[model samples]
Target: MLLTTAAVMSALVLLASGGAWAFTGWASGRLDRIDPFGALGDRPEDGPRGALTFLLVGADDRSGLTREELDRLNLGRDEGGARTDTMMLVHLNRERDAISVVALPRDSWVTIPGHGPAKINAAYSFGGPQLAVQTVERATGVRIDHYAEVNFLGFLRVVDALGGVRICLPEPISDPRSGLQLPAGTHVVDGAGALAYVRTRSTAGGDLDRIDRQQRFISALLEAATDTRTLSDPARFTAFSETVLQTVTVDDGLTGGALLELGNQLRSVSMDDVTFTTVPAAQTDFTAPTGESAVLWDTEAARELFGRISRDEPLAEPSPPAAAQAGGAAEEPAQAAPELIVPPADITVQVRNGAGIQGLGARADEELRAAGFNVPVPADNWVGGTVEQTVVRHAAHRADSARTVAAALPGSRLERAGELGDGVEVVLGPDYQGVRAVEAAAPDSAGSGGIQAATATDNVCA
Candidate 1:
């Protein structure tokens, strides 16, 4: 249905060092190519030595869908054109252990070389991938060594081939525009559902939330793609590989051997090594000379960000709190403050009925999900038996995530547990009331003073 995630994650998983173990030269040889950088001039200088940066875009091509399929999928009639629906930069550090998938907002206001200022996406509509690459390089000063684009198909095939990918939502979304309808909870979705999930932006934070969905789905797909069972099964891997080659069009220079070499370098990479974030914005709505409202990047912040990328460094470290900065000694953030790095949507939760009331746990689960917590599992009996007071128990390392949960339960007390792992557990007591809405910590509030970021290991879906 939609090829958004494959444009980056699958490429990162299947084409880069991870999927090349069984991938043959024949498979790489079959990939179609469009030289994205060949005709461009005044390109930016190369980035950090030994680092590889690839620009990936999802090409919303519907030519392959039949009339019935298009109608069924609700994809409009074919509009013959070259335009990308979304764009992302995939950067791999020199040793290839760490990677960052940075989302570039399509509506970012930027100069398009000869085209002057326009929405970043307009570059592709004007000159296809060539100008798109040129514009991005000109705007960010980061050299793109390779490019690959995904069309409208194969996303479904890959997800279906793997049975399905697991997804967890903090809030329920019902967007008719994208034909996505799902409740808030743990879900293992098939191909069609995956398409709808990635395409819908009706949720809160709009594009930012959509980026979160893509990152989550990508993590799930990559998780399935790397599982020993899927890799060992020749039929499944072959089918998945075929879909990847068919759906993706790479730059002529991104050859099979080149991919194999990079893929092998990143074999040791885990989901934790990959970070997902969006480009920081100074203004979300800037009026252009053409009367278009586009996003504006925070110049100074973005420069430092791109410099770090060019130098093959991780994201800028978050700043210390005001108190810590003043005292020169680090201290825990004031409790009950909305300063958590892991947003509520990213926090995994389990609801248990300790109040002894039938179905109370399920109600709490639904209420928590409605309040934007990821309740991956349904309500259940409390493990430690009944208690008089509601309590939030979590692993010590996950105190921030735990605080996010406690914020939803007005009077819930905090407890530490070693067995609960990374997720937080809530045991409802007689004092338990209804859930209250809680806002995720703002980016600036989180001390990044940039855009929010998370790894697959930290994201809710994974």
Candidate 2:
């Protein structure tokens, strides 16, 4: 009798597992059928083997919201049309050891294939997901393996089902417009609060800062949703799946066995294994032909970064030694310039001699030259007595270059002198000589100087 009971229990377990699998398959299929944009209909043949890319879009439309939801959330002016406020490309590598989430700013200006230059979000409005996918693919040279678009209502529901998410706030957030009020530090955010947090863009850093927050929030959500506790709760999983299906429109390739297989492969990945980064952009205010302020892509850095993704390589981290190596050092032998990499030539560095000692500007200029900066003339702008810090200046249009320069000088404090362009200006503070030595030796430890060559080759606005 005991053996018979074990057999019956095993069969019941198998049946339950099979049932859940069937349900997920059905839900995924239903989602594919509801793709009003027909973005998923085109399946590229060149997709990486066992790898998947999902263009996850978060739309601002609240049409699907119930009257109570609208009232409770205080959503105003139910704009009947949809516009994607958030765009993320989620890459599941073949080995699943790493996942890359690349966020494309909604206000980014890109060529829309048939529609000339336009806001990236406009691609969806023009030709729906198909045009958006095409624009992204053309821009990044990475094909879209799958697609998923979620509305505001869907996002709120998912957050609610997850039993609230924990968010780390560096400062108190009070956005009356979005109805978000939260104290500083880490706090548990519910559905409405999560929505507001991800959607808020009025803070100091604007859209870039908001994207960073959204990435963090999504990371937390992924952790909670994939937790063993959440997975074990069949009722919660069913509700979550239903909510997601009802609101999300996915590509055909993302349905049925494809999605189930992808999910199974990703079951082991944790939040820590995922990395999210915004595409590098010029720190300039782009005035469109229509006089609208739009952001332009930092063509050089962004292209290299995306190329690495297309090749399944990890994103390059700043190597101080590599920077120093590219700058040239008498102690180290120069190697061959890296292939398929281009460094910008119009780099400018401003050297201010703050050291009380004489000839500090000349010395700093020499160090910069050794570190590969083209300095036209050294200036003696030592307004402060005894240099205490170093400042690097780059035009807002050249922020990426400033970041690259700052990375080479890791220990030195970086002050943004938003007055220079495609250039690096150095202020010789008290510790100028020490900082120079530290940065000069950076290239020795960085392997082959290939990464530096890559950075140098990257054009600011391409």
Candidate 3:
């Protein structure tokens, strides 16, 4: 879902800065236009303002591909219907200083306009992008400001134009259906490989697993596009901008100036500032009333998430309110919850190598120390041997303290360990990608159909 959005965001920045002058004008003229939200007819009076939320749709429809290209890419004819394999609700904060990209599981059960309950993606299949936007608004109770659409072939060209994207895999994968065959490590993937990576769903976690991979793919793509080598090279920037504009279709509102505004707002933000997560959902095999298997969103949690977005509040934690004048009521000051806030200087951490990769422990020690944690315990091999997921063990009384430490190292789990005398012990596992601040907390925690987040800065293998 974000593949198109990420590419467009980078292009918009280049356009806004006049970095691709000739290409920008030419590509801007060639951009495909769509009335994505026009069918909805009217905007709600209570719709959110100040912030912008875009409904990014990735269509599996292959309508515009040439016969030879389709055959070459293994894409069959268009089935006379449109279905989005991926949908994401992207939110830009009021200040445009941060971004939260929420992936919407296409299989999630929701109501379609003029139709009863069905898989959310079916809305697009039934009526196109307009109905898809309507269904999302009705289901989440959050108003969407804009829409963007891209097809499979367009995605391929864009990635190829940007050279290639690098992705890290913890284990080898060979999915025949998607044509993605790769070893267990990092590789720079070309267009076809990128498509296969995101399309394959035979992995362990099912659609959920695919969703995670897609999110990671978006981050990696953005990081690659923003690299100094790509940015400084005019030829690379021109090719990227041209391919992206030709590839993506946006609602009428995202004109060149509007795009420049968006790009300017986000100019200073880094990949580290952007966060990606999925909409809370539970996997289910139960048949819907429409006779289709669907993913069920945790209704209670989903509602709360939309509510926060409606008020323009940050989803992770309390946001500072607008300040009031001297005679007026002062806005409540936002603060990190006690459970989430732990000063790096307050605790000591022991680094152990469980990843089997040589010098992993020593690297972790250096990273933790730079992050302000006291790494008094020298890096050593873990007695427990090689593990899969990273774990942070701490004394019983310092569970919250451990969580704080884990926050600094995103993706690591917190556990109880009386063996660690005072602080926490970080055993870097095979899954240990790197050290970076974990994303903000979600409305619901993991394992409960809540949002799972990953930082764009972390190159962790998905």
- In lDDT terms, how accurate is model 2? 0.56
- In candidate 3, position 92 carries an lDDT of 76
Candidate 2 lDDT by residue in tens digits, 240-271? 55655565656655456655555555555554
Per residue, candidate 3 scores C-alpha lDDT tens digits across 176-210 of 77777897677899887887787777654567667
RMSD of 2: 12.5
Q: Candidate 1 or 3, higher lDDT?
A: 1
Deviating ranges (above 4 Å) for candidate 1:
1-3, 16-23, 287-293, 317-449, 460-462
What ranking emerges by lDDT with the best candidate at the front?
1, 3, 2
Listed in order, each prediction's TM-score against the native is: 0.75, 0.64, 0.70
Summing lDDT over every window of 10 consecutive residues in candidate 2, give the lowest-scoring window.
1-10
Error of 2 at 59 (Å): 2.4
Q: Write the per-residue lDDT of candidate 1 for residues 258-368, one digit (tens) a residue.
A: 777777787888877777776777776689889987789878667767777788888643222223322232223324444655567766788889999898998998998
lDDT of 3: 0.66
Q: Would you give me the overall lDDT of model 1?
A: 0.73
Please identify which of the two predictions, 2 or 3, would achieve the higher TM-score against the true structure: 3
Question: Better model by TM-score, 1 or 2?
Answer: 1
Candidate achieving the largest TM-score: 1
